[model samples]
Target: MVFKCPFTMDCAGSVTSSCLVAEPLRSTGGREMLRVHFTAEDLTRIRIRAHPHPLWEVLLSLHLLQTRRGAAIFGPWRRDVRAALHPSGDILTTLAPPKGYSPDFLTPFVDSPELDDGLEVVLSTSSATLRADMTRLAEQTKLPSWAWRIAGGDAEMMRRLADRIRQYHAQALLPYAHVFKSHIREDWARRAEMAMTHGLEHVLSTLHPSIRWRAPVLEVDYPVDQDLSLDGRGLVLVPSFFCWQTSMTFADPALRPVLVYPVDPVIGWASHASATPDARSLEALLGRTRATVLRVIAEKPYLNTKQLARATGTTPSGASQHAAVLRDAGLVNTQRRNNSVVHSLSKRGAMLLDKPALQDRAGYPDIRLSNPSAG
Candidate 1:
C-alpha cells in the first residue's frame, strides 16, 4: 500500500499546498510508517494531553536547533534561541543529536505537565535505566566522557545534565511559551470538540495527513518500521509545537504509549517574536488589558473568573468587568459551568484574532476600552 500527498514540492523543498509540511510528501514511496493496533477497549482509553510537555519540547526544540530542515517555519525562533543560549546549551545539543537516537531518559513521563515535575523525574532516573539508555545511544553516536559518567549514574553528572536541561528550557522554550502554547491549546480545543461532537474515531482520523485511522490500526509516518499494540493501556496524543513534519512514539515500547505529533502549521505563529507584534496590533485596537484578556481566553477557553484574572494579572472584579464588556459586544460567550462563570471567544471574536482584517471587513462594532465607565 502507498500513501501520497496531493501537494508538490517546489525548488526549496516546501510544499506548494498550504495544507501540509514538505517532508511527509517529499518521498511518498519506501517511507516507513508506524502501525498502532488498537482494541475496542483501547479506543475508549485514548487521551490527549491538556498542555505541552516541557521535556518533550526541550528535546524536540534542541533537535530543531541542530538541523535546518524546517527553516521556513523554525528559522526565526532558532535564531533567537541560539542568541539566548548559554555555552552550556551544547550539552543538550550533544545529548540529543539531530538525526539519530536520543536517550529515552531525557524525556521521562511526569505526573503533571509542569516543568518542575518533569525535571524531578529526569533527576530521579533509575540507575539501570540510565545505563541501558546511554548504552543504546552509544551504539549509534559517540558520547563524551561526561555522558559516560551519566551512564554510570554518577550523581554529580546526573545533576549537571538536569541543570543544563533546565537552563536550555528557560532560555529557549519559556520565553516563547505564549505563541507555541497558545497554538497547542487551540489544537487541543479543536480535538476535544471533535471528540465530543463526532466521536473519538473522527478525531484520530483527522489528526494529520501523515496519520490515518484504518479500523483497528492507526498508520503514522515514522523513521522506522514499527508496530505498537495498545493492549488496553490506551494512548496519549500529545500535540507538540516543536515537533515538525512527522509524528513520533517512544523508542522504548515498555514505556507508556504516546504519539507526539506536530500541531497545525501556521507560518506567522512559528516565529519567536510574533506574539509581541500580533499583541501590539491587537492592543492598538483593543486596550492593552482587554486585548490580553481576549488572548488568554482564546488560549484557554472556558476560563472562569478566578482563572482569567490570574492569567491576565488582574483582579477578579476586573476580569469580570472585561469579560462582561466582551460578552456584551458579542465577542465573548459566558456560561455557567459547575456554578462558575466561564469565558470563551465567540465566533466573531475568534475571527478577529485569527484575521485582524476580518474585523474591518465584517464591520464589527467599534469597541471602546478607554472609557472608565466601560470595562
Candidate 2:
C-alpha cells in the first residue's frame, strides 16, 4: 500500500516505488523499522567502506548543520562550519532539508573514493532519473522553480548544483577532514577486529544501538516503515561521523544497497585530536608524565600498557601507573579484553579533551584542506 512521505531525520525518508513492500514487516512502540533481507552471498559480499563516502558525508553533514541535534557531539564542528559557510546557499538547504526526502541523484554511487569523482556522478545523473527524483522530492518538499529547471535536464543548473556542493564541502567539511577520517578509522579498526575475531555476525549485531541482526534480516530503527530485500546483492555498510541517533539507507530500492549508520560519538578520538590541549597547559593540569599518557591515548586508543609505554617512551610500570590514575579519575576506561588490559577514553575523558579552554589555549591551527580518500 502507498503511504504519505515519511518523517526525516538522519536520512530516513519515504520509500517510493519498488523499495517498499506492500506491508511493513514490523513496528514497535510507535517506532518505524527498516528490515534488510540478506543471504549467505550477501554476507560474504558485504563491504565496509575504507573511508567515508565524500558525497554521503556532504549530504549527512548538511542535515546536521540545518538542525540543532547532537549539540554535545557535533556542536563545535557545526559552529565552525556555520562561521565559514556562505549564508546565501539556499540551494543546498533546499536539496538537504532538516527533515524529509532528499533526492537520490544528489549522492550517486562512485567506485573511486574521491569527492570530485562523486560530484561527477551527480553531474551525470540521467535526465529521466533527475526528473523522477525531483518529482518525488516535490511530493514531500516544496522545490523551487530552479529545481524544476534542473529536473528538466538543464545542464547549467546541474553544474551549478555540483559546484555549490563542492564549495560547501571545501568550506564546511575540508577543514575537519582529518577528524572525520580518524573517527571513522577508529570504527573501522573496531569492526575489522570484530570480523576477524568474533566474525561478521558480531559486527552487524553491534553496528549501532538502533540496529539488530536476526539471521537473514538486519533490522534498523527508522523514521518510516519499510523493508528492503537485498536478494543476491550484498549490502555496503557505510559508517558515518555525522549520522546521528539512527541509521539510513536510500529511498530507491533499485540503487545499490548500502546502510549508513552513526559512528559511536563517545569514543571519538578525532574529536579529542582536534581540540587537543597545549603541552604546557596539559602538563600543568595533569603533570608531565600523566599529560603525555592522556595525549597518547587520545591519538591511539585501545593500547595495552606495554604498547602505551613503548609509545610514550615510559616503562610499563610507569604507563600502568598513569593509566590507573586516569581510570580512577574517570578520564579513561581500562578493561581486560583479549587477555590484555586495554585503555580507551571514557565519555568524561572525551568531554574533557573537548573543553573550549584547551582548544583556545592550544592555538590549534586551521586544518589544512588537503585532498584525501573518502569512506
Candidate 3:
C-alpha cells in the first residue's frame, strides 16, 4: 500500500524522510503521541545555524531534539516544525572529520562512562515507558533508507526543510526552555565566582538530571598552566563529545594532574605516530623526495601535483614520482577534480596523524604516552 505522505516528501520522495513525524489522531482513548529522531547527519545540518563559532542556543536545541526524552516531549509537534523548517535532503552526509579538528571533541556530554551508566539507569527505570513508546513508533514508521538521499540533488528543498525543523523544534522546546534557561542562568551567575577561584572556563555544573542529585558537575577548559599542574592535585579528565567544552575534576591540593582526552586518544595517537614518523625516519623510509611530498600533503590536503612540486621545490615529474610512492604506501589518497588530481590523507593516513603512542603502565594499558620521544 503506497499512500502519499501528508508531509512534504524529502528529495528521495520518502514522505517520512523529514526530520520529525507527527501523528494527529488518537485511538479511542484520549492519548496524544508523537515521535522524533535525530541522526548524526541531522546534528551536522543544524550545526550550520550555530556556525563560525559555538552558538549555545542551537546547541541547546540540538541537545533536546537528539535525546530520547526530548524526542518524546516534542514528537507530536514534528509536523508543525517540518512546516516551519521546510526541510530538504541536503543536510546528511558520511564525511569524516577534517584535519587538525577532532570530531571526538564535538561529542555530547553524555559520552562519559560514569554519566552513560547513570543515563542507562534512568532510561531503564524512570524513562522506561517513554522508551517503549518511541520503540513502537519506530517500528510502525520504518522509514526507508533512500530518504536521506533527497538532500543531494535539491538545494531549495534542503533549505526549506532545515528552516522548518529548526522552527518546529524551537516551538516544541518552549515548555522545557524555562528549565534549561534556569540552568544556564545559574551557570552564568556563578561563572564569575567560579572563575575567580577555579580559573577561566571551569565547569559550573553538569546539567544532566541524573547526576544533578549529587554535587553540580564541574569542568575546566585548558588548565591554567600547560604543565598540567592543578596546584598539585590530580585532575580527572572526563570523556565528552561537545567540542571546546570539557568535563574535569580537581581537588583543592596535592597530587599528579590527570589529563583526559574526550575520545580514546591512545588509538588515535598511535595511528598518527605510525603514519607520520619523525622527519628523519620518514626521510629514510621514503627518501627525501617522497618524504617532502608526504609532509606537503600532511600540511595541506588536496594539493595537485603542480602545487605539490612547487611547495616541495621539485619538478612536476619528481613530485609525481614521490606521490606514487605515497599512494603505494597507502599513506595518501587522490581525487580527480577535472584535469587536476587533488591529494589528501587516506583513512590510514589520518588515523596515523591523529593517534599518539600508548604508554606502558599498570592496569591502564590503553593510556598513550604523551611524548613519543620520552623514554
lDDT string for model 3 (1-375, tens) is 011011222344222222222433442334321111222222222100001111222232243233222232334333333332312212211111111111111122232222122223322332333333224323434423332322132344333333433332233332122233333334334433443455322321322221111111122222111112233221333222221122222211122232222221122322233244543455566675565566556645677988676555567888888888778889888789999998876776655544212211111111111111121
Q: Tens digit of lDDT per residue, candidate 2, span 238-330?
A: 888878775777778888888888886654333564455533455678875686677667645788998777555567999999999999999
lDDT at residue 107 of model 2 (Cα atoms): 71
RMSD to native, candidate 3: 21.3
lDDT of 1 by residue, 1-375 (tens): 121112222457543332212243332456667789887777767777767888888888887787675677787778766765667777787778765567778877664665657878888889999998888777757788988899989999877777677556655765466666668778877876776666766788888889998878998866445678889887878888888776767777788888888885566554534454454466677776686677667655787998677555567999899999888988889999998999887888877766331222121111111111121
TM-score of each: 0.67, 0.67, 0.24
Indicate the TM-score of model 1: 0.67
Candidate 1: the clashing residue pairs are none
lDDT of 2: 0.70
CA RMSD per model (angstroms): 13.9, 15.7, 21.3
Error of 2 at 130 (Å): 0.4
